[model samples]
Target chain A: MHKIMFVLLCLLSGCAAQHNNIKLANQLQQEPPEKILSILSEKEPDQSDFAQYYLNLGYLQLLSGEFELSIDSLLKAKNEMLSLQATSISENVAAGTVNETFRRYSGYPTDRVMVHNMLALSYLFNNGIDDARVEMLQADVEMKKLAQSDSLNGQLASTHLLSAIIYELLDERSNAFISYQLAEKILKERNISLPRGLKLGLLRMSDKMGNDTQYQYYSKQYPVLSKLKQVRQKKHQVFGLYFDGVVSNKVQQSLAVPSFNGKQIVRVSMPAYTSVQHRDQHNQINDNEQKINSEVVENVDKLVREDLDKEYPSILLLTTTRAIAKYQLVKEAQDKDPILGILANLATIFSEVADLRSWNMLPATIQFSYLETDADHIVVSTNHQGDSVVELAALKQHVILSTGLSDKVFHYEQ
Target chain B: MKIQSSFWLAIVASVILSACSTSVERLDAQQQIDLSGAWNDTDSQLVAREMIEDSLSRAWISKFVKSEGKDPAVIVGRVKNLSHEHINTNTFIANMERELINSGEVQFVASSANRQEIRDERADQDLNASEATRKEMGQEYGADFMMQGQINTIIDVDGSTQVRFYQVNLELISIKDNRKVWIGEKKIKKLVKNSKLRG
Candidate 1:
């Protein structure tokens, strides 16, 4: 008996397990798979076959092997079914069909137990097994709470199967197989055919303990499981994203990989990305600046600022070969910008200042990147090439790098 | 008396003619050259400035710095000339830097090229024995930022007019933070009339 269910002595008239079956079926416009799942699970069941919509939609994504997203949708349907399974109590109990709360949900729409089992199976078989088991654990925790109230619910084999897969992955083999055996027994007693690979594994374990008939039975079952596996392989399509050679290196940089030393190292400093920088940029103001309202600011100064040199955070270093330098200037020597003289003069002053300041912000501290084209890597124009037309179109390619750091120089990339 | 009068007038006319022509041209052995209009050096500067500023715009430096990030005080560093020609990208950067700074959105660190002038001024400020004693200025921090790069150019001529292209790139790095925070690029194109090629 499912513990969450109750026996109503008074039969509510016309409710006949058709609680929500009055609506017409309609399809939704294309949307993110997650949304479709939610609408299906939340709609009234008997009045409309909303559950079927979820089931069919989820099936398409699942069969396509978009496991994480597919499972998310399936779980929504599972949640709806579980909620519908809850019946109003009459302070009494019944057995057998009375505990079919899953079927008796809202409209008594369909055989929902099968749906739960299949979802559990799908979660286990598809990608990210651990994620699937996390949901199953939540179900178990909820089911346990219900049992104390009604005493009708018993251990569900589907939940155990999910648990077994998780435990096996976690290397708690003994517990995993114990759960697996319980599921096999419950399934067998229901006269369901045990898939052969699983049946064989269990039989082999039993046979090791001297169970002869069990060993022989599952050995025969192995061929069928093997065939099912082959069919599944043929039915499923596998797609992959391939990055070759230097291209892979570029991708790694954009993704921000940590260095071999297992330290966070970023070559190009995007200090603004840090929460501390955000606080500094948005919150802290110099005395010279005018004051603004406090509420207008986001609370970001809460964290302490750490030195970046010591931190060595992981970084994505983006590079490009297809780079062009173009400018627009109205030249006047008589009115030659006094600022130009000042700007040029900074170099000489800084070089001398570097000696006085012992390599402070003086000079030599400035870093630069080179624009490499087929022509040359020259930094300054001798004559008038910088204003050339058709610079960017002639670019070769771009290099996006995930790079490591060192005390001496920033590594090109790892 | 009539012959003497004609001689005086002729002398006056010669003086006026010499005075009018002399300021306009200077003798170089057998030939005289004109110094008015544009000098080769000024042309060098115009072409260089155009090239560098063009590089800056194409580099899209503003798009990076002004993009929802903290405005760093950029300091101008070395605009070295590695080419045979006298390359001056600083003048180009100065214009861009002013635009960046004056927007009231950005700040520029004191240039490295001016550090000693600052120092010598500070040094001149010190007390000395003589009434004519010069003061040495006190020291200041290295610029909180540095912006510097190079400019390269290509030129070709079709008769009197020439086509030229220039690229100038600048990088801004913070001193205290040691972060390369900004990059600016600009390129210049021009058609200049060549007096030497005239018919």
Candidate 2:
């Protein structure tokens, strides 16, 4: 009986491994990105959690300006996510018997699409335009697949806008127009107001593609399309992307119910998000005469919350069943011996933890702004950092990516 | 009780040791081995071989040879990879070059990078080497046609099953007239099913 209790305790201890992940999430907010990256890089790959590991590592590497390494890590994460799409019987059994964390961290729907988005950015930063185009097409395929499964879960406006930008850069005006249209449709479906940059892109692509009716509709509605058209031939264009603060970390919520005539305690644990306060901050880009503030394109916090909400019912059912099963085991042990019952109850209490694992290193919101200028460079500044100059040189198009966590700015030109 | 403990301990030890061990095997390179079902060497080689074969048999090569009174010089240009995978287009281009050169029907010139290196070597010889052995710069043959292409793929995934369709398109364009003299296309489709259980 004692041996059985010891084995159960050991298994429950294994379920508590996510405490380290929670600690790491806390560390991400305090430590420098390079230090955190070094720590994550030193970790050996956990086969079951490999996707989550690489996902976090890749994002940090991207923030640290390691474009090539980030691309490699993100690709590995993508491949692992693909392979893990198949249901694992053993992992399912572990999930049912132990805790939800025992199951592999096969990415959520948002993660699947974001993986391709990040890969596209990584390729663009590395000056691999053709590879970036491939990632955008893959993102489109991923979004379509996600739409087939769940109508509203995987549609990301940032991905579509980025795809449109890449297509326009490649001189594929027709594809660029389609992508811009898709981005607009997604924003409309989600009830998110279209940003000026996206609106301008639609207007420009529509006018270029000879869609007079749609162009006229937007021009009438926005009234700024005329001004945008006037500056269309500005010799150089700059697009600014700002990744906001880290996304919220998931915390465990436990509910205990007395059962078996108030003798046995049944505990149900589920993952939940705590409200974050700094959700509205954004970065600003400035030239000598004008200042452009990035508009929120994707609120990653809301996407994560929506993803969790969609799966809440199933999670509740499974967690309730597991809790009841665990309570019954404790009751049986008590009927046999009081000592065994006490030990089993202790194990249950320790092991009944929610799966708090997530790709927590992602930004809370992704913002975008566009500027068409004939100038050589522009100044970008955030609340936490001073102004930084981004040189455009003679490039016809340029992209600037910055994150709130660091002052480092990554740029690419074409 | 002791026997049971020993037996369990042996089982755990064996499992750990087995997992820690690594194994290696060698086989013929030409043998087709599909793992993860993404694009591989076999697909690259087969596509290059068949596409080049089709391009060489077309009327463009015979017409060029008859009109020019010699085998037309060819240069391999950029073969863009626009697929989901990071395919090494260089290997595919090299395979096509090998096939074209081995056919004994066309002349193959060095690519841009290789030509630059060769030009540098000739310039070095002009300054440092004896004049009797120096190679002239302007005597090099200009390519009559350039081979350029792109690889594209469409993947459809359902549950544990995925169907990958790859389309490779190659075109030979006349350098002087900018006319596409020949176009060759090869398509490959694969159906992959992944197992749902792990040991």
Candidate 3:
């Protein structure tokens, strides 16, 4: 009765969590950008919907002149968006969609583009002219191709408007003039009214170009563009949520076993948890950042030096080791098994660690990340010899997560 | 025999426990971070390092000396994204820029992001030059070469077992010559699966 009650309680909690997630998603979907952003910031949830919520909220923030907050929310969604390929943080990042958007990362693109365009426009809108210019060029070249084929013409025209703004920033009056003209043309052709505040910039731009006729045309149309050059230069803010543990492949698994024509038997398994400990030993890893957790790092260090050497000795076979571990686990009812999905997430965590350490040592970019503990289940198995002449402990099984990268065929040169 | 065996068992168990406890060290914990170096891939990093080294070795560039010459040339054209994974080319190019500046090979156009940052930080003008002065520096030291590239992957599977492949291709094109001064490619591959554990 007690066991049944416990099981029932667990189910009830899971359902409640699910319910909350649906409510949150519905709430974010309906709210205005400011309200959406406020809600996203107020609560941190681990579900994909929450991350998506933040991404949408961030986009709205960018629209409403809250660049710093937009940058913050976008960065938050990015860190949480697990699948790699889909997240477009930038259009240039998205152009690789055909070949680059791996099946695992596909979920990220929709949300990815929201922040990407916002950042681009924010930079362009506020007058980070060159940054905006490159972003616009990249958007015009990379994203426009995709957006045009799709039914998002208004956004596409807006992208062009931002690009024109970039040209204006560089004092490249010609390019700016042409782009603005194109934007105006796009608005008219698409049958979309010129957004209320947009005409003033066109007027200002025409006046700068000394095109009296064009200037007169725009001057006659109340130019609402404010003279203040906006700079979406707010520093990103980060709030620590859950430190969700993730597993992924350490490097592109490329150590292929040479096929022995007939004699040698080769064995393989799904894949092993990339030992994160190996990332720092041989080459210099840039970990000289000022802030970091000491205890956790020390634990990682110990695991690298000792556990990795024992389990994955140089030139070792992951299959044999995991098999032995699995057999041991089964004998003792240990739940962690290679078949269970866990190793991949662990490898991804290590990869993120390696990437983070290296990313920090460079020239400063407006970047921030927060670490918080979420949840993870660790499975373990033990094995004992059943009826052997010599007493020997057999194996141990553990769960590992295989990054989705493992399944998809990657081909660059065909 | 049982007593001796139990004692040995305890020793082994203790060793195993201790070993597992300290499995990460110099291998897991990095000493310092140089985010400047591209975190994209090891093989690609090596290739860029070598190509930049090669460029620096050239006699013309080796001899050219400048007190504060920055801003090189613009990128010649688009770089193909060849790899299966979408890698941000900026991650790698940014490193190349730092190396160029460090070696004093060439300069880069101040990305508006960086330019804006500089201006914001130095709002107090007497301590630093104004925005106009900085923009002038960008023109004085224009870029000479543009770096771009792609990443690709390959996989071969025999029944359930498989072999995976990865390659990153990069090229440094000279704006003046329109010539591909340097092209570098790096490949990585892995094998997975075994029937030994089949039920």
Please give the RMSD of candidate 2 to the true structure. Answer: 2.4
Q: Flag the better candidate by DockQ, 1 or 2.
A: 2
DockQ of each: 0.00, 0.59, 0.03
Q: Give per-residue CA lDDT, model 3, range A306-409, as digits (tens).
A: 22233343213433443334333333332444333133222211211110000000001111112111112111111111111111122111101111111111
Candidate 2 per-residue C-alpha lDDT over A1-414 given as tens digits, one digit per residue, 9 for 90 to 100:
567667666555545446665677678777767888998788775566789989999999988989899999999999888878777888776677667877878888889999988988988999988888888988888887678533679889889989998999988888898998898888888888888888888888888888899888888878866576756488877888999887888988998877758777777889998876765678888878778999988888889888888879988887877887788889999999988887778777766778777888888899999888877878999887678998889879988998878889999898
Best-fitting candidate, scored by lDDT: 2
Q: How does residue A197 of candidate 2 score in lDDT? A: 85
TM-score-based ranking: 2, 3, 1
What tens digits encode model 1's per-residue C-alpha lDDT throughout A322-379?
A: 0000001111211366454333222212111000000000000011111223331111
In order, candidate lDDTs are 0.36, 0.85, 0.40
Candidate 2: interface RMSD equals 2.1
Where in model 2 is the C-alpha error above 4 Å? A1-17, A148-150, B1-8, B195-199
User: If both were scored by TM-score, which would come out higher, candidate 1 or candidate 2?
Assistant: 2
Proportion of true inter-chain contacts also present in candidate 2: 0.61
Candidate that scores best on TM-score = 2
Model 2 CA lDDT for position A257: 77
RMSD to the hidden true structure, all candidates: 41.6, 2.4, 24.7
Per-residue alpha-carbon lDDT of candidate 2 for residues B144-171, written as tens digits (9 for 90 to 100):
9999999989899776677999999999
